[model samples]
Target: MTVAEIFPWQQVLWQQIRQPENLKRHHALLLKGRKGIGKLGFAFGLTQSVLCGQVDAAGVACGKCQDCYWFEQGLHPNFRLLEPEALSAPGGAAGKENEEGRVEAAGTKSGKKPSQQITIAQIRSLDDFIYLSAHQARDKVVLIHPAEAMNTAAANALLKKLEEPPEGVLFILVAHGASLIPATVLSRCRQIAMPAPEHKLARDWLVRQGITDPDFRLAISGFSPLLALQHDEQQSAPHADFIQSLCVPEKFDPIGLAEKLHKQDLSSVTSWLQKWCYDLMSSRISGRVRYHLQQADSIKRQAALMNPVAVGFMWRNLAASQQLARHPLNSRLFLEELFLTYGELIRPVGSETR
Candidate 1:
């Protein structure tokens, strides 16, 4: 993808990448942002640009160059993409162990055994790759997507290499949240913060990608185009329905809602909750709520009834829940607790019953 097509924030980042002076001292670079903002794509593109045999005026890699061709074909010896073995698991972090306290490898789509994390063993393997003379005698690029996925030991192992990287070697670390990374890791690298896209721009991009529903765009993604594409209308319908049910002044069923959500994957539940909070936040600000358009009147009424401070408080709780769900948490209990919190938030103040 062209730099302009990547994301607005990425285009700004490309300016820094294009200047050789900017690359002088920084060997390890960390690009961090929210998911679906194209951090990984930007990392890959940056790597290819650095290794490309031919570059255009914009300093973008010429697609037909040998290096670019090999990269596209996944045959570039000088380029490496490192991630946790379970590619689909969020942020590539290890999942919880089973009843016996034995950690299972994360599941892979190819049915290959899951790897616990990007282990020190994997980091050591890179030494063999990098220690060799540069493939093209130009630059050797290693793109470590979701660098935070490295376990503590693995991160420390990688840190040693980062401290004294081989000549002509470049390491790009991509993470959604840099807080997960250790302070040592943060200090060693030059950080590139990829901000979220503009809401209207992202919406237009999503519409071009065939997401036509305005409500869908607003609900699923506040300002990230990549996230907008990941949400499916079919899956979002139930979430909207659940919110509608809660908007009414009636007994809400937290257990039933949690069960329904448990049927879906953890990522979907997190996304739904994130979107729901955004919708509520938007409703509070705009005095218009369209996430559940059919229940707009009810939502408006509920929004009016709730205290703004409490709503803000609930938003923070939901964010915490999202992070907690990432690692080993009782999914059922987590959902139950979240919904119960929501129930309490929407309940009439000083009510004896919720």
Candidate 2:
């Protein structure tokens, strides 16, 4: 069996932490970083290594071992993974949990939309895993991904466990927004600030994955390699359409665009608008475009004719929109309102000649 690969950028960190002594010192690890930087993959790699029946001198999992087999099959008696039910749903966040690549969660077999927030029931269900003796008397590992997704009740429930952690059990919490997690919970874990790769490094990694126009994807993904890959595979068309419409603000039909995008993830759609406005503000003030390098010319033109103060306000307003995007009462109405507001920010290309 081949050991799953960790991202190249993580090699240094992996080397430093893979030592058995390092892992033995911590009962819980909080792996925090920007979205799509592969925190989940790192956590899984660490878990596999720790549970492997045979580990190398470098403390890497021997995938050929029985424990590795169990892990790959998702039937490891000693391992449990906790994540929002939404993530397990079709077309949902997957490993893309935060701003860069959140997808709308689909409904479960019961036709109910899977929840985006981790519930208290999930935390409570861990009782057996946390209290019961580990299989074969080995260490038990419980991994909660995007720990911030836990609601207040869930968080409080987990806090009780963290406060008096049982021996031989390891809790690994992965979070994109660690600040959203409770301070009391954070204090109980060994926090690790996961690293994002440099531009060149991330670009190189994307290239190796056969991504074309890697830089554009990388920039739009907030420089996260995993999110960049996700954009290439899943989001390319909708994103391009959204940008093209924005490029021609005069021809932009908010209702039409909203109609087209309402079926998509509200959070993701809002994020695109947020990034576009960010570029607009950035262009107007500093003559720079951050996310939309391909649309620099259009952004520059639009920025020149817009009010920097108004754009600044609009950009800030979108932050609130992001929060609302999660559970909007009417997605179409929400988007229509969003685009209509953007339409007000930009005058037609030739409306005012310099």
Candidate 3:
């Protein structure tokens, strides 16, 4: 891995952040935003530029100098990347352009699932890296991706470092859920709420990546171009089937649908329903559907007959379901109940014939 390229949508913020004054003022930066919009890539690019022996007037790494060469080869003595073991595995999301960089493959325990949380041991082990003399007497950087993955012990350990700043060191923490981070930790870093590109910009980027019907892909993936690409490449068929089941709520089999989709990522499954329900509600109120662009006519017809109060309540209830989706004891049972509730909301008593 070479340096991560900053996306077109990120140009303005990139320039703003790359300013010498901004870099000098903040020793640590918390880059927080929705996932799949290149927050990791931005962090990676910033790391490279900071360590570059020859940075351009634009503050981008020249990629031709010794420091840049070592960084690309993952041998930069002054730089370290901290990420979960799962993400460092071969063929993991870390390998993708949308979410790049894994300094080295993490050692996995045989027959055991790789740990997801950043361990206290990992944070503690950073003392030498932080306090030691730099390889070239330059600034050292430590990047923690998905910083929300830090467990309580790990976070507390990191807080110690943040509380007493280390000279000549920079910390870049990338996170999708900033709320999960402890308040004290949050307060210590310069928090940057990363931007998502506008619909047109996102759709154009997806189209350039060879995604057909970019509007629907963009909408379904919450307007994130990288996510839209992932969805199109990985989940198009399953997502279409899921949407089809939702389109005909009266005839759909919640049990069967749940069985089919239970093996999938529950969080993603919940989001699909959330977006679909949102479209149903939006279509009824504003005569428009947001996520399911190709299914607008069906949504309009269904929304017209549905009880608005019931739909609203169900939509609100999905928020709680989303939380449970993360740690459901029984995936199939959880999804079955979810679909059954949606069924009731869409075709409540005396509303089917309306």
Candidate 4:
């Protein structure tokens, strides 16, 4: 599918993609953004746009052409899509287990598990693919999703290719955080920053999808429409109620709240916390609040009582808690510490004296 078909917001980016003048000197392009924002989709569309033998005046691929048809069927020799094999999910066959175990063992020797890191074997295979002649199109396109999954060695190996890439080849690296990549990799490609959609735009998109809840909009303001939909379904009902309770300090229980959150997915939990903070900042600044506005009074009260630096420190702690959640840890204790720290940060300084 075309970029426009994948994401309506991509029209702006597609305009630039269509301009031949804009394409010069950037054979390797990095598209960096959070997950579920259609970065991979965009990269795929750009691949088709570049490789399509027939193109319309609007610069969109003619989907009916042989090249597009092959691409649609995953038979196109010119297009390569690579992702971590761990993403395939676990269980099923013994053979599958053996294969995965071997890959994982190889990965571990290289300092990371296969599920955690894309191995050097995977990166080396790209060289063979890129060196071969394209079957139909003028260029060969390689799209690497979550490129940060490459281990240090794998990343370095890929860097050598990026430094002196073959002619008529394009490398598209999709990353959630560009900071994870080496400076050499960062310097080799054109960087495209894809920020989250505007709140109103996200809300409108959600409404079109039949989700009209104000709470849902508040919970996912800065996320893409796809992620908002997922969160609306996956975020626990109790979690929703708990977030609402932030408005009423009497209902807040640091340990109990932490216990609840510890059961949820790390990415979703961190996303919710980030969006909540963004909403709090909006309430503090614009007085035009969306979700969790009932907590506005408490938020403002605490904001006034605490030093601004201390408040910033609390945010930093929240981010750290989220990051720490990524690795293996005692979820209960970790979350308890996080919420207790939050409670301490929000409590009035002189309440003990009273």
For candidate 2, write residues 1-354 as lDDT tens digits: 112457888898899888777888889999999888888888888889888989888778889888999998878999988888888677675655445435466778999888878899999999998898889999889999779989999999999998898889899998988999999999999999998999999999989988988898889988988878777456679989999999987788989999999988788888889899999989988999989998999999999988888889998998999889978999999999998888877765456531
For candidate 4, report its TM-score. 0.78
lDDT of each residue in 1-354, candidate 1, tens digit only:
212134565676788677877765678899887776777667777887888888787778888878888887777899877766665354333221111112334555786677646788878889878888987688888877568778999999998998887888889898876899999988999998886766676777677777777445554454456655755556767766666557665667888888877755555576565556555666777977644555566667777777777777787776666556656367888888888877876778778864
Candidate 2: residue 7 lDDT (0-100): 80
On lDDT, the leading prediction is 2
> Which should have the higher lDDT, number 1 or number 3?
3
Clashes of 3: 0
| Comparison by TM-score, 2 against 4, better one | 2
For candidate 1, the per-residue lDDT at 210 reads 77
lDDT of 3 by residue, 1-354 (tens): 424778889999999999999998898999999877888788889999999989999999998999988888988989988877666665444534232122223455574556677889989989999998888889899999779889999999999999998988999999888999999999999999999898888888878877778887777766777767766346667888999887776678889999999988777788788888888899999998778888999999888888887888888988888778867999999999998887777765665633
Candidate 4 minimal-lDDT segment of 10 residues: 92-101
lDDT of 4: 0.66
Candidate 1 overall Cα lDDT vs. reference? 0.70
lDDT-wise, the better of 1 and 4 is: 1
Off by over 4 Å in 4: 1-6, 21-25, 33-36, 73-75, 88-114, 195-200, 218-223, 259-262, 274-295, 327-329
Give the per-residue Cα lDDT of candidate 2 at 63. 90
lDDT of each: 0.70, 0.86, 0.83, 0.66
